[model samples]
Structure formats: structure tokens, C-alpha cells
Target: MKILNRCTLEFTSIPENVAFARVAVAAFASQLDYTLPELEEIKVAVSEAVGNAIIHGYRNRPDKIVRVNVTIYKEGLEIQVVDSGIGIADIDLAMQPAYSTDPERMGLGFVFMQSFSDRLQVDSSPGKGTTVTMFKQMGLRKARARAN
Candidate 1:
């Protein structure tokens, strides 16, 4: 099954959207036949990335839009979350786990993305916003992970 769907929404820089993004991932996972273990990792990574976009990238700019794109392929699924707000100045520094621009954040978003997905690609420029693309194989690979 080859299906692609995208949604863009703007919400105030509230913490609620963090969970909301995970819920969206869970619904998408159901369509992909993601195993329970796969679903949990996807949920955590999506929440972290979406939360980073809403909190750090937008920095409370409620007017900014966050775009989430989900594509399902025969072998796996890919999810992209994009934000056209303030971008990361240093991709290397931003991706470091436990390193955060804001004191409140533990800066493990990218770390979790890498740990959870088979692949994670991040594209960003200082003023051009950031897009995180994550991919993971379903079915057998997921079952193997759960068995471990």
C-alpha cells in the first residue's frame, strides 16, 4: 500500500500539542500495522520532534504552522514534521542529547529520533526552518525488535 497524507496546523505554544502529535502517530501506525513496540517508539520520537518544533523552533509563536507529513510504503513508513519558524543555528549542537537552547529542555529529541527510527534525516537553515524525516520498517523488523 502506497499512501501519503499531510496536515498543517497552527496552535498556541501550549504543551498539549506534544501529546496530540503522538496521538496522530498512533492513528497513523494503526494504518501501517505497526507492532506495539514500534508504536511506542514512534510515539515518543514524534512527540519529541513535534514538541521541539513547537517550543524551541516557534518559541511561542502561535501563528507559526507545523506541518506533519506521513507516507506509507510497502516496506516501511516515513514521517516528516516541518516548521517554518526560527531555525537551529547549529545542527550539531542542537542534536546533542542533554544539550538544549532552553534550560527547561533536556535536548534529547534528535537523540530519540535516531534511537527509534531506522533512519532520521534533519534539514534546517538558520532562518529557513527545520524538517525532520524519520523512517522505520514494519512487520518483521518490528517483531524482531520486540523480541529482543
Candidate 2:
């Protein structure tokens, strides 16, 4: 896909930055002709990815770094959230619905990310870190409307 625009953000792995990441990505994505609901989905996906990076990847360590990269294509957009923290040993188990490392948490982050995006991929190793990539295609609403 031809790249139309792109941006990279690096922030401290703090919980407050989740909202910042969400709004920033949504704003960048608005350059496309996405509807309001689609934009909301984009925000939710971003929030979950970033939140997971800070919470699970970094283990709530604010000193760590979380990076977010967003790229826009003619067809849609791609979002990547990366953290250099403890990585997941079992990606398959982690992606399962309501499965969280922390018992207190709901573990629905991946579920929200998967439902909102056209595609979702999680890459991680035991020590390397984690990267969550999500793709949201444009004009999905129109296609769904026509189908119904």
C-alpha cells in the first residue's frame, strides 16, 4: 500500500498516556473519511493496545517507554504499539477472551482490539518485549450497510 501519512510517538509508560495515544491516533486517522463510530472504534483499539503495553508489557513501571506508530494507506490505517518490557510466553493463551495475567483485571483488551480492527496481530517473546499491530480498513460501514 502507498503510504499517505505517518507519525510516531514515544511516551513514558504511564496510565495517563493511554488517553493521549487514543486521541492522537484518532486525530491522525480523521484525515481519512471515517465515520464517527469508526473513529470511536479506532480510539478504543488504540486505548487497549497502549493500555496493555503499560499494564502488561511494562508491568505498570512508569519508567519504561511505549512507542506508537500509525500509518495511513489509501485503503485503511495501521497502528502499532510497542514496549520494551517483559514479553508474553504464550501469545495464544493471552489472546483468549477474559484471559489476563492479572486476576484483578478483566482481560478484555485483546477482545476489544480484535473486534474493532479489521486485523490484529500480537508479537512477543519471553524477554524481548511485545508489539501489538492492528489494521482498520476504511469504508467498512458502507460495505456492511449494503450487505444488510
Candidate 3:
């Protein structure tokens, strides 16, 4: 897809940065004709991706870096969250509902991301790291169709 706008944010892998990443990405995505609810979904997806990077990828370590790359394409908004920490061994198992590496935490992160975005992809290697990509389609066409 054609890129209309893009921005990248790099921050330490801390819990607070999850909110920052979500808000920053949502602001960038606002350039498109997305409804308020659509924007909220995007924010939730961003939070889950970044939170997973900090909690699971870095294992709560505060020094590692988390990168968020957001691109507004002609058809949708794409957000990628990357972390250079311990990666998942089995993506399928991890994606199952309530299947978190940590027993104390709910494993609904992937579920929320998948439900909120048009498409979701996760890439990782055992020792390398993890990258979560989520795309939310612009709502203008949907709204127009509904109006018609």
C-alpha cells in the first residue's frame, strides 16, 4: 500500500511507555478518517503489543529498548512493535486464549490485538526477539457503505 505518513518511536522497555506508544500511534492514525471507536481499538491494540514486548519479551527488564513504527497507508494504519529480548518458542501456543507465559497475567493480549485490528501478525525466534504488527483499516469506506 502507498504510505501517506509514518513515524517511529524508540523507548526503554518499561510499563509506562505502553501508554505513550498507544497515544502517540493513535494521534498519528487520527490523520485518517477513523471513527472514535476505531481509534480506541487501535489504542488498545497498541497497548497490548507494547505491553507484551515489555512484560514477556524483556521479562520486565527496564533497560531494553522497544521500538514502535507506525505507518499510515492509503487503505489503513499499520503499527509494528519490536523488542530485542527473549522471544516466543511457540507462537501458536502463546496465542491461545488465556495462555500467558506468566501465570499471574491473563493472556488476552493477542486476542485483543486480533479482535481490534483488521490483521495481526507476530514474528519471533527463540533467542532473537519479537515483532508484533497490527493493521486497522480506515473506516471512511465502511461508514460510507453503511450510510448508503
Candidate 4:
């Protein structure tokens, strides 16, 4: 697949910005003619990833940055979100359904990422921060089976 488009944005660790980030990603996914449900899935997954960066990665420090990079390709889209916050000590724990380092959140972020996209990967270290990568493929007017 060819790379069609991409975008990168740095956001402050604020709750309001969570919805803002979701809107941005949703808008970009729209260009691909993703179904409404697919777009919602993208928005939720992206929001959770970005929210993790702002909360766990940055520790609400306010000074750190949550960098979101989106790439649109012939098959679909890819995203890499990076943050200089406290990295996850247990990738497995972070991924468990309803798991969370924070109490308020239900810890569905990683779950949503896995549930919504064709692929999701996370690279991180205790001090080195974290990078989350996600991929989605846009098919014809009708949905099609993805090739492995």
C-alpha cells in the first residue's frame, strides 16, 4: 500500500484535549470513508492512547508533551503516539481488560486499541517513555477480508 497522508500534533496533558484529539483522528479517518462505527472505534482507541500518554506517560506533569503521528496509506492508516511520561512497568498488565494505573479510568484503552484496529504495537521502557503504533486498512465501498 502507498502512503497517502499523515499528521503530527503535540498536545498538553489536559482532559479537554482528549476529545479534541479524538476529533482530529476521526476527521482524518473520515477521508478514507470509514464507516461511522469504524470511525468511532478509531476515535476511542486514539483517545485512550493519547490519554495514556498524558496521564501515565507524563504523570500530569503539564510540561511534558504527547506527540501523535498519523499516517494514511493505501491499505489504511498507521499511528505512532509518543510520550515522555512514566513508562508502563508491566506491558501485560497495561493491556489487561479494565486494567489501569489510575483509578478513575476503566483500563480499557489497550483493549480498545486491540479491538478496533487491524494491528497494534507498543514499545516502551521504564524511563524511555512509550510509543504506540496502530494500523487500519480501508477497503472498497464494501468491507473486505484483510490479507495476512
Winning candidate number (lDDT): 2
- Report, for every candidate in turn, its global Cα lDDT versus the true structure: 0.80, 0.93, 0.91, 0.84
Scored against the true structure, residue 70 in model 3 reaches a CA lDDT of 93
Indicate the TM-score of model 2: 0.93
Each prediction's RMSD over C-alphas, in Å, is: 4.2, 3.6, 2.8, 3.1
The lDDT, on a scale of 0 to 1, for candidate 4 is 0.84
Q: Model 4 segments beyond 4 Å from truth?
A: 140-148
Candidate order, TM-score descending: 3, 2, 4, 1
Q: Which residue runs does candidate 2 get wrong by more than 4 Å?
A: 140-148
Q: What C-alpha lDDT, on a 0 to 100 scale, does residue 28 get in candidate 2?
A: 94
Model 4 over residues 47-134: C-alpha lDDT tens digits? 8898889888887777777888999876788878888777878898889998887898888889989998899999989988999999
Residue pair clashes in candidate 1? none
C-alpha lDDT of residue 103 in model 4: 99
Q: Between which residue pairs do clashes occur in model 4?
A: 57-85, 57-86, 58-85
Per-model TM-score, in order, reads 0.85, 0.93, 0.94, 0.89
Q: Give candidate 1 regions above 4 Å deviation.
A: 1-13, 141-148
Q: Cα miss at 98, model 2 (Å)? A: 0.7
Per-residue CA lDDT of model 3 for 37-74, tens digit only, reads: 98999999999999999999999999999999999877
